[model samples]
Target: MKVMKVAIIDYNMGNLHSVGRAVKHVAPGGTQVEITADPDFIRHADRIVFPGQGAARDCMRELETRGLSEIVREVAKTKPFLGICMGMQVLMEFSEENAGVECMGVYAGKVNYFKHLNIAHLKTPQMGWNQIQQKTAHPLWTGIKDAARFYFVHSYYVEPTDQSLVSGETFYGLNYASAIAKDNVFAIQAHPEKSAEDGLRLLANFMQWQP
Candidate 1:
């Protein structure tokens, strides 16, 4: 069998070390994880992971500056693309957090900050561990139990127009789209790298997921 080569997009926004380490640990031997800024590598990668660690506009700018916008879009179309943290948010058409910046538009929606009646008591960022209520079953959640707690560090959340695209959700003053997948594009608001065992399993599942 050919080894599954995973390309972790090194767009300067990803938590590179942690994500790279986690993929190395969970994936089978011969599965190589490469951190690359090269568009060609990303375009040809068997699996692509778009991990983000900072602001939405900054990340979008970086992709545009590096001329990776269209390349990333092409990769997402054919290969299994996984987005984490701000990476996940960038999959949408726009982000309310950034005001006017456009995103990859893989998913139809806008990412917005938390706002609800019960939100006054809770924190803004919603940092630390939270239970991800699995909404729709996907290959990425195989062998993973329901209500799995994943590490999250974000203030904004995705409000997808297509409800069917949502794969999982979490409550932080309000229920938000924590995970979503439509065809080859898969994304998560939670950080699987910091999520321990279940996170590892999620990464493993992504490695084996065939688009």
Candidate 2:
């Protein structure tokens, strides 16, 4: 049987092993998950999983440093792309981290810090399990119940200019886009690898998603 290649992009930002293991765990019998930063390998993969954890400035710097910025932009335009955490933030136009930083600008949005909000006193990162309110139907949310809790660890959240792009929302102090999808690109602010059963189920669905 032929194998489906899934690439977990490694741009020297975060741990790729866990993401790779989760993909492998849910991948069907002929699916192969490769963790790499090679442009050739990424361009040729069947699907791309971009996951990261770090400041937006650092992440973008690493991507450019490794000469993967354009590669990522190209893959995102044509493949079933999944961006997690910092991966999701980089899709926006700019981030308010490290004073300010320019990003991939795939989506017309900005990443903002979750501070000084006059809501419930929540921590800055909004870490731990949080319920994801499904805003629209998508293959990525298949079999996943509404308000399913997922693991999140971040001090900033994505605010897309087009609200229709938001596929999921979660309330830390205020309701913010927890997931966004457009065409072949789907990004989530949470970490599916550490998100347990529902998270694994989402990954499994991604493995079979035709889009």
Candidate 3:
């Protein structure tokens, strides 16, 4: 059996299919990527991937219903975890989306909608490709460039109270935390599966990341 087991957490609100394909693509022949909702299966994995897309209310609601919320928090702290898109947002203390949401509190911060920013000229849900300015050195960003462009599709952006934890920043209407990292957890507000070359490079890096 492959010793490197990567669990793409399935809380029923994520793009598991795409994310799994992405991970498997970069993963070596000796690595195994499993999409699972079983807590024990996830807890035992070598790496964890928390991926989500859509409203905060639904994401939190589903996680609670499936009893995966706490598991997510626990695994994030214990392993090399990667949170993508809504996965990254929910790691914060709260979110302005869906009329305020109490997040997992993994980080001290909140997610905000672009409309609430009061920048009328700027478009909400800054979709398509955007450049990420690397603010810190990380194993996941091994081969990626400094100002690498990644795929993003969200109206809400995360603002962490601890700005020092931010690994990457992106500018839309304003500069916001596109990625954050501390210890074994690395979270990003972009979808690597749809990000093409650099995105694949990130996943490739994560597969070998010792953190």
Q: Model 1 over residues 1-211: C-alpha lDDT tens digits?
A: 9767889988788689999999989888888689998887787779998899888899999999989888888888899899899888988899876666788898789888774335557788889999999998899999899998999998888989999999999998888899998898889999999998899999989988887
Please give, for residues 82-201, the per-residue lDDT of candidate 3 as tens digits.
Answer: 999999999999999878989999989989889987987888779899999999999989989999999999999999999999999999988999999999999999999999999999
The residue ranges of model 3 lying beyond 4 angstroms of the native Cα positions read none
- Model 1 worst lDDT run, 10 consecutive residues: 113-122
Q: Specify the highest-lDDT model's number.
A: 2
lDDT string for model 2 (34-114, tens) is 999889999999999999999999999999999999999999999999999999999999999999999999989899989
List the RMSD of every prediction in angstroms.
Answer: 1.5, 1.0, 1.0
Task: Report the Cα lDDT for residue 109, model 3.
Answer: 91
Whole-structure CA lDDT of model 2: 0.93
Give the higher-TM-score candidate: 1 or 3: 3
* Model 1, runs deviating above 4 Å: 115-118
TM-score of each candidate structure, all chains considered together:
0.95, 0.97, 0.97
Question: How many residue pairs clash in model 1?
Answer: 0
lDDT of 2 at 32: 74
Clashing residue pair totals per candidate (backbone < 3 A): 0, 0, 0
Q: lDDT of all the models against the reference?
A: 0.88, 0.93, 0.92
Instruction: Report the CA-based lDDT of candidate 3 relative to the real structure.
Output: 0.92
